[model samples]
Target: MMKIHEIRELIKLIDQSTINEFEYEENGAIVKMKKGVDAQVVSTFVPAPVAKQEIIAQPTVTSVATIEKIVEEPKAAEEVAKVEDANLHKITSPMVGTFYSSPSPDAANYVSVGDKVNDSSIVCIVEAMKLFNEIEAEVQGEIVEVLVKDGQLVEFGQPLFLVKA
Candidate 1:
């Protein structure tokens, strides 16, 4: 079982970091925190006797304000991207990780708007657990949009690029 002080420390770290969600589990205990419009910190414990659960909604005043601001920025950006490329082929992330447009910080991006790509072409890289995996364009087309910013965390099936197939 994690102490309240430890949990408070975890929350502080999350608020200071770029991580939007965090999960920790140990000895039948699970702690999960997610930042958003209605940010929440949930902790669950399962005992051997039967099935027991508890959910605590403790959002700090400062955290709530910060979370709303963080959430709003992303929504605004996504809306613009969707409006501009409503009819394009979306290349989504295959796994959760940080999205990188170029191979290196100083290198050129693998694909840019108006660039032609085939099914085998490398479009970007998704870094997961210290490993950088090259993402391919499964559809042959000209790139019409880049949905995610470089170094942004992306989830599985999240749109990375829009291709005009």
Candidate 2:
């Protein structure tokens, strides 16, 4: 996990960088930051409700965007869960990166819709900062849907596949 000072430094570095968004995760802690057109600082981390609220409430920052919209936005996410079939398992991206269906441009995809997969099967890869991270289908099931296309940018926790277990 990143220390409080480290998080602050990251926020500053992201604010100054050309990139518009960044996400870092250690263990299960995640830090996400975004810069809007006005250059306001927008950041979030999961599992640390206090850290999340405190970051928004920090007095040192000139203008931190309100967390209300960010906080409320995820509430609507539950509705999607309700809409999905109860027996289906969602394969989600663990980090913010680009989704790749195959190992190489001409290689066969790791898995396709209608393909059977076990708990340890490599379903796809997500590339972040030149690192190719192989993504696994943690559920034993048939992939019923592929939610993302190759070379697409995906967000942390965004579902990439739906499987019927």
Candidate of highest TM-score: 2
* Candidate 1: stretches off by over 4 Å: 1-86
Query: Each candidate's lDDT (Cα)?
Result: 0.87, 0.85
Residue 46, model 1: Cα distance from true site in angstroms:
27
Model 1 residue 15 lDDT score: 91
Find the 10 residues in a row with the least total lDDT in model 2: 47-56
TM-score of each predicted structure versus truth: 0.50, 0.53
Best by the lDDT measure: 1
Cα lDDT tens digits for candidate 1, 1-165: 999999999999999998988989999999999887465655433323636354344446657787677657766887897776776888999888999999999999999999999999999999999999999999999998899999999887888998998
* Residue 124 C-alpha lDDT in model 1: 98
TM-score of 1: 0.50
lDDT of 1 at 125: 98
* Angstrom error at residue 57, model 2: 50
